[model samples]
Target: MKTQVAIIGAGPAGLFLGHLLKAEGIDCVVIERQTPDHVLSRIRAGVLEQVTVGLMERLGLDARLKAEGLVEGGFNLADGERLIRIDCQGLTGKTVVVYGQTEITRDLMEAAPSRGLEVIYGVGDVAVHDIESDAPYVTWTKDGSAGRIDARFIIGCDGFHGPSRKAIPASAAREFERVYPFGWLGILADVPPCHDELIYANHERGFALASMRSHTRSRYYIDVPLTEKVEDWSDDRLWDELAIRLGPDAAANMTRGPALEKSIAPLRSYVFEPMRHGSLLLCGDAAHIVPPTGAKGLNLAASDVHYACEALAGWFKRNDADAVAGYSERALARVWKSERFSWSLTKLMHRFPEDGPFERKMQVAELEYIASSVAAQAAIAENYVGLPV
Candidate 1:
């Protein structure tokens, strides 16, 4: 098979890229190693910045999103019993929506067939070849059958553990990473949210977050040691901890329920430089990763896809080679900004084992400053809502 672009992975990044290219009359094919069901089953971030929502709108797949997504004007930061609210809309003239990443993926996936975007799922041993040349290809096997796609460009949206990023020679790239000592133990349940807006609390106990997937589906989390096991805490235990850490106001409205999904996700900040290696361009987790503290993971990926689409469009349609050559520098600028925001929020809201009296005081002082200063609030709101594309 031949195409202008071969996208590896059918997750949001890959799917978004495929749809964007196809919209511009550029032929692209998506390859996936997992079944569609498995891909949608993975739990992920629910917050959506304007950039993400804009992409959905551009693809004309936002009917469900606009109807169901919870529009949040602002969110709160908790210092024990106090809730310091940052008015994102007032400060930045923008707001975010509470929509699950799975829903976005489903919208894109469902719209693909109608829009003539082809995705090959449930393939194995997927690999990229000859990325150093103008002509590159992707190969995979399934059910004892082998398949190949020859393309002018191979996009590695296959994620951190996938084979796409590894295809780039180590000598041509640089990696930066910081693994946090604690992980977020989250619970997803079918119940009303405790609060109208999301809350990030930094209590003496630890860090806790109160969020929602919808009016009836609540998602909450608390930072726990990486060594802790999920089995150690039952549904009741986790709920109890959330109530205590989120403080009295949120606790009063909180409803206890059985866990629909519960697990511990480790936190990390990772970036692989030079997103483009010859004909292979990296997107989403293939190029970068940010902790979920600031809800930048999915939004960051959307921004990457937006840039990737533009670069590819420029290359094929306008016959501009510099756009492809400059893809890395362009994407990295926004990637680093988001990484900083996520890391900063994580530090402000989490109780680290290595942190002592001074660190605790610093967290308190910083939160206090943010609450009192509109300038401080604006800075956060700007990044939270996302920078311009």
Candidate 2:
């Protein structure tokens, strides 16, 4: 197969990139290691920043999202007994949409086939070759048969665990990483959300979050040790920890149900400098990953695709590689900013045993300042709701 661009991975980044490029009259192909059903059902991030919502709307994918997604004016930050709400709309003049990542993946997958785009799923032995040559190709096997796809450019939208990043020469890359001692044990329940808005709770025990996926389905997470296993947690134990962390008032609003799913995601901050190399470029999780605290993962991935689309489109139009040339530096600028925000949020909300009494007091003072000061509130509001696209 031959095309203008070959996108590896059918996750949000690759699928969205293909859709955007197709809209711009660019020919492209997308390949994924997982089946369409799996891609559509894989649950991850849900919160959509204002810029992400706008991008989806502009791309004509908002019809279903607007109908099914829950719009929140802002979120609440609670420190045990006290709570403060940061109005996203009031501060940033924008509201966030809470729709599951699965929904967006399903929508994009369903839309792709009709647009004359090809998406090969359940493929194996995927590899990128000839990056230095004019013709970069993706080689893989489908149905026990080997295949080759040649394209003018290849995009490594395959996420963190994907091979795209590994294909790059180590000498050409600079990796920055920080793994936290804690992880989040996230749960999907059949019960309704305890609160109207998302709540971030800071307690002596740990951090707890009350968020929702839909009206009837709620998602919640509690900070746990990185070494802890899901098997070690029973429903009663989970509820007990959640109740303690969420405090008495918030616990009253929460009613536990049969957990639909549960998983532990380690908290970490990582960034790979220069997201592009030769004819192959990386975007989204393939390039960087941020902790879930700031709710920037999905939004940052979308931003990466938007910037990459512009660069690819420019390359097609002017035949100048300037946009592609600067893709790394440009994307890294925003990526680092998001990294800082996510890190800051994680530090503020999670308890650390390493902290002294003074440090613990400082954390309380910071929370108090954010709750009492308009300026501090606005800063958190802007980061939480989103920055301009």
Candidate 3:
């Protein structure tokens, strides 16, 4: 196979980049190691920043998203008693959509063929070679046969663990990371959300969040020790913890149901500097990771894809080499800002074992300041709604 760009991973980022490139009349092929069914089975975050929503709109793939997604003008921050609502629309004139990342991937997947986007799933042994040179190619195996793709650029949207990022030499990159002490034990069920807007609660016990995928599907999470096991918590036990932490108001309207899916995900703040290494440009988890506190993970990926599209189109369509050379610097600026926001939000909302009384008091005082100060609220609101892409 041969193309202008070869994208690894069929996740939202890779698929989004492929769709955008195809729309730009730049030929690209996406490669994935998982089956389409397996890809869709992985549950992920549901918040949609404008960058994410706009991409779907630009690709003409927002029909299902527009019909099914819930539009929220604001979200809430609770210190176990009162809801400190950050009026995102009023403060920043913007709103976020409650739409699942899996849904976005599906939309891109279903629209791929019609848009002339090629995505190869369920491949094995995928690798990129000669990325430092102008001519780079990707090789993989499927059905016990080897395959190869020669392209002008090989995009590493394959994620952090995928071969693409590893292909970059350690000497050329600098890694920064902070792994959180706790993990979010999440529950997804077919029940209505407890509140109209998403709530991130900081309670005496720990941290909890009440979020929704739709009017009938709710997604809730509570921070737990990293040593905790998912199998240990029954549905009733999880719901009971959520009630106490989210406060009485949310608990009053909360609906409990059987868990459709439940799991514990460790939180981490990770960023690999210089997202581009020659012809291999990293996007999404391939380049960085943010805690889910501010719902920046998938949106960050979308922003990377936006830049990747711009860079690739400029190179292929306009013959601009500077566009490709500048991709890393441009993408990293926004990535670091999001990294800071997610880290700060995680620190404010979660209880650390090492945090003493002073730390707790500081969190309380900061929350109070945010609730009382419009400037503080506006800052939070802008970051929450997402900064300009």
Candidate 4:
């Protein structure tokens, strides 16, 4: 097979890239290691920044999102007794929507075949070859049969564990990472949300979040040790802890049913420098990852792909490689900003048992300042609504 661009991974990064490129009259093929059902059913991030919503609107992908998504004007920072509202609409003149990642994948996949795009599923042994040559290729196996695809350029959107990032030479890339001592035990319950907007609570026990997926279903998370396992947590114990951390005041009016899903995600910050090499470019989790504190993971992924699409379009239309050459630097500016915001939010909300008394006191002071000062509130509101794409 041959095409102008061969994109690895069918997740948001790769799928959205293919969609944008096709709209620009660029021919591309997308390859995925998972079936369509798997990609559509996998539960992931749900928050959408205003910039992301505008992008989707321009692409004609907002009909279902607008119908099914819940729009919120702001979020609240609470400490059981005290509540401070950060009005996203008032501060930034923008609002956020709560829509599942799975829904976006479903919409993109449904639109792929109509665009004359090829998506190969259940593939194996995906690899990038001849990166230094003019004709870099992606080779893979489908249904026990091997095949090769040659393209003028290739993109690795296969995520952090895939072969995309590994193909880059270690000497040419600078890797930076930090792992937190705590992780979030997230739960999906078959109950209505307790609050109208997301509540980020800081308590002496730990950090807790009150969020929802829909009117009938809710999502919640509590900070726990990195070593804790989901199996060790029972439904009663989970609700009990949630009640304590989210505050007994709010929990009193809230009702919860059996948990539909539960998982633990470790907190980490990772970035790979120089997200491009020769004919291959990387985007999304393949290039960087931020803690979920600021809800930047999905939004950042969308932003990176938007930049990449513009760069690729310039290269194809004007034969100008300048945009392509500057892709890494351009994406990194936003990536680092997001990293800083996520880290700051995590540090303020989560309790670190390893921290000394001074550090712990400092964290409390920061939280108090954010709640009391309008300037500090505005800073958080701006980043939370999202920085410019």
Candidate 5:
């Protein structure tokens, strides 16, 4: 197979990039190691920053999202007993959309074919060759047969665990990371959210968050030790812990049901210095990862796709190498900001094992400042809603 650009991964970032490139009249193909069913079945965060929503609209893919997604105007920061509300719309004139990542992937997958985009799934032994040269090609195997795609550029949207990042030589990339001592044990249930807005709590025990995917579906999480296992948490036990951490009011109003999905996700902050090496460029989780505290993971992916599309389009249309040449730096600038936001939020909301009484007091003081000061709230709102792409 031959194409102008080859995209590795069928996640939202790759799919969105392919759709955007096709709209720009650029030929592109997506390669994935997972089946479409497997991709769509994975559960992920739902909060959509304003910019991400705008991109979906630009792609003519926001009808379902606009109708079904919950519009969140604000969120709450709680220090166990007291809740501090940050008015997102008031501070930034923007609101986030609560549309699951799975839905976004489904929308892109459904729209790809109609837009003349191509994708190959269930492949093995995927590798990149001659990425430093003007011409780059990708190879894989499917059903005991070898496959190859010769393209002008190869994009790695394959995520943190994917092969794309590993293909980049270690000498060409500088890695930075911080693995937190805790993880989030989350559950999805078919029950209305206890509150209209998401509530993030910093309790004596740990951290807890009350969120929702829709009007009737609730998603909640509690901070847990890295050594904890999901099997260690029963539905009843989890609920008891959540209610205690959420405080009196929310706990009293909270309803519980059988969990549809449950899992433990470790918190981490990771990034590669430059997102590009030769004709092989990385996007989204392939390049960096942020803790879920700031809800920046999927949003960052969308922004990366936007930048990639712009860079590729500029390269093909005007023979301008500037955008392509600077893609890494430009994308890294935004990525670092998000990482800071996620890191800050994580620190503020979670109780670290190393935190002394002084550190806990500091966290409380910071939350108090954010609650009392308009300037502080605005800063949090601006970053939470997302920085410009």
Candidate 6:
């Protein structure tokens, strides 16, 4: 098969790109190693920044999101007994929407068939070939049959372990990574959320986040050692830990129920420099990852896609190569800012194993300042709602 672009992932990044390119009369194909069901089954963070929600609206994909997603005007940051609420909408004139990543993926996937965009799922051995050359192509195996797509460009949205990033020479790819010392043990339950808005709490025990997918579905997390396993945490034990970390109010209102999903995710900040290499450019998790503390992961991906879609559109629509040539530079500018925000938020809300009394005091001081000062709150609100794409 021959196309203008070959996308090596069916995740939001790739799907969004496909739709964006198609709207401009560009041909593209998406390849995925996993089945559609598997992709939808994976649980991910839901918070959508204004930039992301705007993109969804522009694409005519906001109907379900607007109707079902919860718009949160503010969120809370708790330090032991003290609660600091940051008014996101009041400070930045923007609010975040709580709609799970799975729903976004499903919406995009469902819309693909009607638009005639091609997505080959359950494929294996997907690889990019001759990316350094203008005549780039992708190869894979599907149902024991070999498949190849000759394309003008190859985009890697396949994520951290995907082969697209590795296709770049080790000498050219500069990677920076920091794996945290702990993980978040999270649970999804069919119960009302403890609070109307998300609450990020720092306590003597660890960190806890009270979040939700809907009025009836709640998602919560608490920090745990890297060695901790899901099997080690009973439902009761997890709830108890959350109550202790969340303080008196949250614990008292918390609803107990059987968890539908439970898993531990290790925190990390990772970025790969030069997001573009020849005809191959990277987007989303393939190029960068942020700690979930700031809820920037999916929004970051949306921002990358916004840049990429514009670049690709410029190339195909106007025969302008300047934006496409400068894709990496432009994307990295926002990527670094998001990285800093996520890293800062992580440090602020999480208890480091190595933190001494002085470090603890510093965290408390900063949190107090943020709570007391309107300027500090505005800055936090701006970053939280998202920087302009």
lDDT of each: 0.95, 0.89, 0.95, 0.88, 0.94, 0.93
Residues 89-203, model 2: lDDT tens digits: 8987878889988888888888888877788899999999988788989999999899889999999999999988888899999999988888999889889898989999999
Tens-digit lDDT string for candidate 6 (180-240) = 9999999999999999999999998999999999999999999899999999999999999
Q: Give candidate 1's total backbone clashes.
A: 0
lDDT of 2 at 57: 83
Q: What lDDT score goes with residue 216 in model 2?
A: 91
Report residue 72 deviation for candidate 3 (angstroms).
0.6
RMSD of 3: 0.6
TM for candidate 3 is 0.99
Off by over 4 Å in 2: none
What are the models' TM-scores?
A: 0.99, 0.98, 0.99, 0.98, 0.99, 0.99
Model 3 Cα lDDT, one tens digit per residue, 1-389: 88889999999999999998989989989999999999999899999999999999999999999999999999999997799999999999999999998899899999999998888889999989999998999999999999999999999998879999898899999999999999999999999999999999999999999999999999999999999999999999999999999999999999999999999999999999889999999999998999999999999999999999999989988999999999999999999999999999999999999999999999999999999999999999999999997
> What clash count does candidate 3 reach?
0
In model 1, pairs of residues that clash are none
Can you write out model 5's per-residue Cα lDDT over 208-320, one digit (the tens) per residue? 99999998999999999999999999999999999999999999889999999999999899998689999999999999999999899999999988889899999999899
Q: What's the CA error at residue 357 for candidate 3, in Å?
A: 0.8
Per-residue lDDT of 177 in model 6: 95
TM-score of candidate 1 to 2 decimals: 0.99
- What does the lDDT come to for candidate 6? 0.93
For candidate 1, the per-residue lDDT at 219 reads 95
Off by over 4 Å in 1: none
Q: How accurate is candidate 4 locally (lDDT)?
A: 0.88
